[model samples]
Target: MHMTDVLAAADISKAVAAFAAADSFNHKQFFVMCGLKAKSKDDMKKVFHILDKDQSGFIEQEELCLILKGFTPEGRNLSDKETTALLAAGDKDGDGKIGIDEFVTLVSES
Candidate 1:
């Protein structure tokens, strides 16, 4: 399975705005640095699911900070401003949150 398969199980393109947390996503590193070995798409999705804390099928801003925690050695969350950029970096729909597709594509492409 791939990240696409995992995200495909979710609803597509639901507009959600705002995420709450404070840290940064280092563009220098790989997306799987977020606790995902993610050589395969399914692996990426698993990481996505792990980040989607509310289980709303969307990885909200707060959740994204938590995800960033794993990506860092200090296990620190992202700053709210930085988190917004992370969302914007891949939020193709401008929903303010990272949907499955956005996340999968972001990681897969990288």
Candidate 2:
């Protein structure tokens, strides 16, 4: 990988490690740790796209469960309970998954 890619990967690994030790899942703090504190709706949308691994325009529970792995190959998977809670928080429309708009709002407001 390029130097910048390697550096970013290292940063993400540290962030993921810190997040894994937190008592509760705090989406806003997690995002900030990952250097994903969006300065605009468009920036937030990009982050949502990254998390939406299937490119289905939504973040399913399965995707959320493995969200940390998106940052680094060694990142641990989120527990079932954590995944469900995160889904419920972002799935504002009672949908089983988080759409782009919901994702943006969830991160922006938190």
Candidate 3:
């Protein structure tokens, strides 16, 4: 299945899942899963590419919302309060935009 399909099917922490599968995804297994090959840097780039659908070199609000949908893979959707909090925390410019850098930073910090 596609990664996003795996994500949507999950009912737990994606971080936990990814970490648990780290051995496989770290360098080798990702190739097997995706039918492609790449170095670590390339892999990271692909992830960011997937996150930046608009190809604006930055993630926007809609992109962020899609990402937030996957944050809690436990099938426990975020409450309105939680969503608001997430936007507030990551919307650095406060122009109602959360760029890819901001999202990446927020996810990394979390």
Candidate 4:
């Protein structure tokens, strides 16, 4: 179903407020919530490109850490330990980095 179909006009304010208050918003959740996937893969691709700061095909340690900063309400950065753990969880290829495929896989499954 479309996002609009799922969300009433009256519920929009609350949904947006909740989204804004969230510490972190993942791609799959976003796509599903906004019905972007129902439209096309382009939205996901755009989000990925935006997160890929250096335009590198892969997301490296620093990039992940930088992004994690937005994952907390306090604007706190991810510690090295936290970053490593995140990598361990998301880097499926053992390549020490997260590729687009891995990224999509992580979010889609979550």
Q: Which candidate is the best by lDDT?
A: 2
Model 1 lDDT per residue over 9-54, tens place: 1211110111121332453243433223345767666767766767
Query: What's each prediction's clash count?
Result: 9, 0, 2, 0
* Residue 63 lDDT (model 3): 58
| lDDT of predicted model 3 | 0.45
Model 3 agreement with the true structure over 53-107: per-residue lDDT tens digits:
6778765556544542333333233344444555677677786666656655544
Q: Which regions of candidate 3 deviate over 4 angstroms?
A: 1-68, 71-76
Candidate 2: worst 10 consecutive residues by lDDT? 1-10
Question: Could you tell me every candidate's TM-score relative to the true structure?
Answer: 0.65, 0.80, 0.43, 0.57
lDDT of 1: 0.56
**Per-residue lDDT for 1-110 in model 4, tens only?**
22234334344333333345334434345445544344434544554555577889877898876543322223334567656766676799899998887766655664
**Winning model by TM-score:** 2
By lDDT, the better pick of 3 and 4 is 4
Q: Clashes in model 4: which pairs?
A: none
Predicted structure 2: lDDT: 0.74
lDDT of 1 at 4: 36
What TM-score number comes out for model 3? 0.43
